[model samples]
Target chain A: MKSMLRTETQSKRRWRYVYAIIPSRKEHDFGQIGLDDENVYTIHYREIAAVVSDSSTKTFEVLDYGITHQQALEKIMKEYCVIPMSFGQSTTEGDIKTFLSRNYPKLRIYFTKLVGKTELGLKVTWKIDTTIKEIASSNIKIRAMKHQIEGKPLEKTYRQRLTLGTKVAEELTKREEKIASEIFARLGRISADAKMNKNLSDEMVLNAAFLVDKTKEQDFDTLVNTLEQEYGEKLLMKYVVAPPYNFVNVRIRS
Target chain B: MALIVDDLLRLPVDLGMKVLQAIADDADAMTLKTERAVREQVLKTQMQFERGDLPEEEYRATMSQLRKRLDEVKGV
Candidate 1:
């Protein structure tokens, strides 16, 4: 939201941000050495990556931390080249290395195909204020409550309002998911990976990752452009492709 | 240790495939350490981490220490 954090150093083993742990399989690590270290049992993964936390404590101290997620996502294009792991990934070193080596040939081929590429993650969200306002304007449920409450006790009337609010929340979830899914579904072929962020909020409607060939970055841009021209207001889309800009290139066109 | 494994340990996508190929390649001497054995070991560590019995930092710390010790033994 603010600005992505960045630094210049001669660090060799670069770490990049993959939005979450789910898509770890997408990059096809194919034995090319992903995690840097493992714990005592030689099973737990402790990567010697550069992904540091954006939390202030890690930001102030770079020598012993990974690069910030904000830094990785913001620079998706130029300097950072990243292969995002789907949310939630962990493994031991020896097994993981063997896994990589086994997949090494295919993964090497994957690297040649996607070496300079970056993934852009874009999500669309809508706040409740507008949706609630729309509901109040069109739905007769509130009007019926107002009419019936004139004769009932205040507590009873308040309980009815609470019920109305619950229904609104439920309907909002269903409607938003439908809209979000339909839009991103159109992008199925263009993406190497896609996922909807269902954890942050029930209202999170759209979450997707688009893998673009370096030369076709503009094609992805045009696809987004078409979406904005149709649904600019009431929808907010934020995105980043890594290794290029550690600063989020946020823009909203009216 | 009495071994315990997590769900990821048995993921059809990752296991079997990595080791099976090496076994087929004829150049590997890892006949004893099959995929299932490695998987059981990885999962045991993971289950410990998940149950809050093991701290991630401590787990990684121990893993690296073993790797280092192994390297020393191999004189590599």
Candidate 2:
């Protein structure tokens, strides 16, 4: 009796949840859409793949067939690099179609120009110690303070030393910002264009994306290699090119 | 075929549905045993600091412990 009432209310105010489809396939399909035991089709918009979520639960499920979404997103991502919607997005198929239909003129122009390109992301992480060591060598003031604070009681000196730790972290961040600027300038010299995702974290410097012509990937890597060689002592950088979707992670290996 | 609960008895905490159930069902994932626990374990420290119930040093030490435990339970 309760379920029947719930279903009645559901039918009256029906809505679909949204799913962000990260596809492994390089080719985008525009068929009648794939369906499960229930009938629903995914709306593949440019590189931003969207699908309505299941209705019974408020949750929009994500499936990872261990075909890692990263690689899958990249495979399809090469087709037409586009904006990825931020999390918790939902819309009906008909609304999406109307959206696409209305914006077809603008999209066609954007798609045609972006047909033969992919976005490559590069992030440089400095081993914290290396940068700290580098900074410690450069800053005599900090070294003097470090030496002065020794031979004191733990309570008196512990917080004092932590302030130094915070100082070192701040200096390390400034150095990364400097290197990041240099890298972006260098990328502009090599690529058709570049975009930098600048964030101050111990993890990565040079968080940047480049619009590399398909033929220019090797040249881009070769350039990156040269930069890495010159600066590899203090910084370690890795790259992830934007896959077909608006490229955007966490802990468990599982 | 499966064991079903027909009678009410004080049992274990509710593992909230789906992927979370596995961890939540475990005794370890009690995180906060109840809403009261949220207030007692986490918010109380924060409130005490605001209310001048704890010195800054004591508040920080206690808060760090709660943060560490919360991190472990939340897997953040």
Candidate 3:
């Protein structure tokens, strides 16, 4: 009864959940530890291969699934140049081949472009109170407006308050743009390519991903450290190292 | 459903049909108005948060509630 139960469990682990594709050299099995630690392996074609594992479950917890997907991609990336799929992307081995065959040109392009490169993410968020104080003290027009309303009661200076508010908004927007561009310029030189994501929250001033050479990774980290130290009080810097390049390379329709 | 439950029980059969028809005609408009209001509210809160009038935790909670309301309206 125990042997039969084990055999049924083994047969249950048949469906493959693909994680990403890398250059084909040999058929390799990365072992269990994929989505739910199902045996991970590869399906090789002519010059490329799909990294996959047994997809035992028909449904998965989205958050947990996402973490496992990223972990799988990271594992593959450690030894090979991989172009990752969007999170939770999975299919059978046959469908994976069809996908590879259909998108061979783009796949080849991705392979060539990402051969020895990895992506890094940087997010910079302004300390709103500190930045507002700095702006109020340094901006001449704002300082003048503040001077006018220095001792006036709120009810009496309503119009001036409104004017100052509008002016502050405009000036803050301009400053954010200027600062974002300045930071991008400073780091963009060391990167092979860079993409800016729309800020996810109000505190965020910059959310950008850079495609960088593996060899230059340390230099990039050092530069980021210096920038963080320089803007220590004014902004918070979050740096992510060698994340999967899905931000730039994950969208292939075919 | 609330409109029907609250008013349908009190009305005579003939009047209830008329009221049901009226509600049926207005249901789409009501939902549209609700979606627009939710959208505007989200934008306002987002602006307040951006301008530093709202704190991050409060803004995040408000945005999450607004998004849930939006999804309910969209029936998603």
Candidate 4:
């Protein structure tokens, strides 16, 4: 009896680490698939349910847990449309039920809009040296500046070199913008919605996410393949189908 | 030292405690802000590593350094 009382007290102290919210009235046991091999399950309140695991700790280091959290969401997405909760969201079971009860209508609308759709990521990069070479040949002003600087001592033509560098950078920005817009326009036509993410590097020309309906997923894939072929050796394209990390993040008030 | 003692004697005990508490709270807030900023940097570093911008050795070194800073801020 004393051990049972200790068990009860420990259970009361454990918080629910939420992964996602799905539209379901039935309870589910996702087995021991959570971080640290915890049992992942669903807690239902009417038609909405929160996918969670009993966690003793409230805070998680993102470096250790971020990928696990995303993988868990992806696993759950296979069977249901997931409204992903941000990492480190831990609260009591009672609070989750109350939250679900209060936000049922809004959550239902998210599911309605998100069903039968997926997010795809596209990143385009180009070799900076090759692009600069192409720019120097085609841009007359840059070509003339380069000709003036060619074979001159570094100290003697410093000012001309600076101007030439500035011109090259300006041309690079213009070219990147043009290419990004064209790519976005092509893919945006087939997507329900699209978002342009910040490019991470100088070589990266485009970083974008598209919310495409399941029906148009194949068409989107074909278009991306076509783009890859068209760009050939000039650009490197990386395409991936991912969870709508950019589109939806459900922030539940604790 | 005598003048400092005189000022402390003039102040009420609860008021002195409140002043200390406010300073502590401000320090706590600053630590929390630094912790959050470090966490964001860690995430950005991870994104760069995943995007192939940062090499493996450099990524690992940066992540370890950031984690140490995070532990320091949190007093872990």
- Root-mean-square deviation per candidate: 20.6, 17.2, 14.1, 15.8
Q: CA shift at B69, candidate 2, in angstroms? A: 14
Q: Write model 4 residue lDDT over A1-254, tens digit each, in one string.
A: 99999898778757888989998889999888888778899999888899998887777777787657766777898898788776677888899998998889888888887889987788999866556667766888876866666666768876666676667767878989999999999999999889888896667899998989999999999999999898756688887767676777677754
Model 2: per-residue lDDT, tens digit, A90-143? Answer: 444566656655655655555554456666767778765455556765888766
My TM-score estimates for the predictions, one after another, are 0.45, 0.53, 0.69, 0.80
Which residue pairs in candidate 4 have backbone atoms (N, alpha carbon, C) closer than 3 angstroms, thus clashing?
none
lDDT of 1 by residue, A65-179 (tens): 1223222333322333433332123332343445444544554454454555555666677754555445444667744543454455546555654555555556666768777
lDDT of each: 0.41, 0.51, 0.69, 0.77
Q: Residue A129 of candidate 2: its Cα lDDT?
A: 49
Q: Which of candidates 3 and 4 is the stronger one according to lDDT?
A: 4
**What's the TM for model 2?**
0.53
| Higher-ranked by DockQ: 1 or 3 | 3
The alpha-carbon lDDT assigned to residue B68 of candidate 4 equals 82
User: Whose lDDT is higher: candidate 1's or candidate 4's?
Assistant: 4
How many clashes does each candidate structure show, in the order listed? 37, 6, 1, 0
TM-score of chain A of each: 0.54, 0.64, 0.84, 0.92
DockQ for the candidate 3 complex? 0.02
Clashing pairs in 2: A17-A53, A74-A243, A76-A244, A77-A243, A77-A244, A124-A205
**What is candidate 1's CA lDDT for residue A139?**
62
Name the candidate that leads on DockQ. 4
